[model samples]
Target: MVMVEVRQRLVVGISGASGVIYGIRALQRLSELGIETHLIMSRAAKITLAHETDLKVAAVEAMADVVYSPDDIGAAVSSGSFATMGLLVAPCSIRTLSEIATGVTSSLLPRAADVALKERRTVVLMVREAPLHAGHLKSMLAANDMGAIIAPPVPAFYTRPASVDDIVDHSVGRALDLFGLRIDIPRWRE
Candidate 1:
């Protein structure tokens, strides 16, 4: 039951990739900006959260304005009528990326992205895998061809990041830029 009825809304999906913090920071920043967030976190993402961060699942869930079960295909976000700015799959796993690319979405994460794509909304996938193979590259290409931005969270050296958090913020900010939700972080200067 989403109640607030905020103006700007976004669908954020977290996969079982390495950098769950990308999604976490996105949630925090989005909340700070008063954008209503609809979160769909994979079960694998819950397990990875335990291994990656000390924060509990409930804490992460609390960051979003609304949370949806990944298995609930009937959720509002699974349809284009939900009226979100778009879907942001942070730390997008290869499996999730492949599913979205092939249009074979079985769960709500990629399903929301599919809906966004079909609705002509911005869909930004922060793919987190390293050492990509032909299949992975092809999937990225296909996703890009389908209007999804395959934005890997590559750190910006020009920002002169002092820590891991800084790198993450810069990358997340850049990704949010694709959605026209600009977070005020260090940017490249002339």
Candidate 2:
């Protein structure tokens, strides 16, 4: 028998943040594009999902091609040889960023991110925090130094978004752009 890998893979980590929608939307878009997604969501992410939308945790998990628990330290994504495009932490929380920056991955989310960094794969962190202090900025710098891309989901006023979905979709699309995935989002025109 012969085995062949088909769709490209990307690890998606949904941390506890105000904009879990970014992670959710990323899953939706990736599914539509036939990209294999490996998902890991923190406990706080599940709680945030309940607060932010009507969807159940299982519903959100169902969006991904594969799912891992935060406590699943031995999950595939926790390894540097997993052969994924990389990890993407949509709506990355400050705490998660600190963990990844410090190389102290207590959960699978950051563990996978750290592994991706060590493997020189693209790790995109959609940081959702604002009013950052020196410490937060320092962590971001540290993560960047480690080769992780800190892409916060800031809206492009140039897009002239009409609804919150438009802004969220655009942000998620832009983050996926880091992986060389060209989503047909509104682009800046001259």
Candidate 3:
């Protein structure tokens, strides 16, 4: 008998933040790398997509290998035992950050993040809010204390990105770097 190994899987969460494009780019890059993606989007994320991008919700969902409803707490990715490389909440909203920090997940997106943290797996949150107040800073600090990586999608000017796509791709590529998966992107040189 022959045994086949399971492909590497990643959990992608999109929250109601202004940078929906970041999540979209992540899915595209992950697909290019041949990794299985399990996606979950908060209700607010769908609305944000409609407002910010031309892509429809169904189009985004189709990019993932699997999709789960925000309210589906019993979804496979919600469990630590599901065996994902990590969870990346691109454009993570402040509300989602607070929920993960306090371990009070009300939706699959945050719950998957919590599960990743509890398992000591990588949980990268690309928090999108600017003009951070003390409360937001504290929440980020709390999440960091619990083993989550607070990776805001700050673009690397060193790359000299020429377009908005370039900037978004650079940020998404850098976040995926945390998982040790190297995708094709411009890198800084000494």
TM per model?
0.96, 0.97, 0.97
Give the CA lDDT, 0 to 100, for residue 22 in model 3.
Answer: 91
Per-residue lDDT of candidate 2, residues 44-121 (tens digit): 999999999999999999999999999999998998867999999998999999999999989899899889999999
Off by over 4 Å in 1: 1-6
User: Which residue pairs come into collision in candidate 2?
Assistant: none
C-alpha lDDT of candidate 3 relative to the true structure = 0.94
lDDT by residue for model 1 over 128-153, one digit each (tens)? 99999999999999999999999999
Error of 1 at 2 (Å): 21
Which scores greater on TM-score, model 1 or model 3? Answer: 3
**lDDT of model 3 at position 90:** 93
User: What are the lDDT scores of the predictions, listed in order?
Assistant: 0.94, 0.94, 0.94
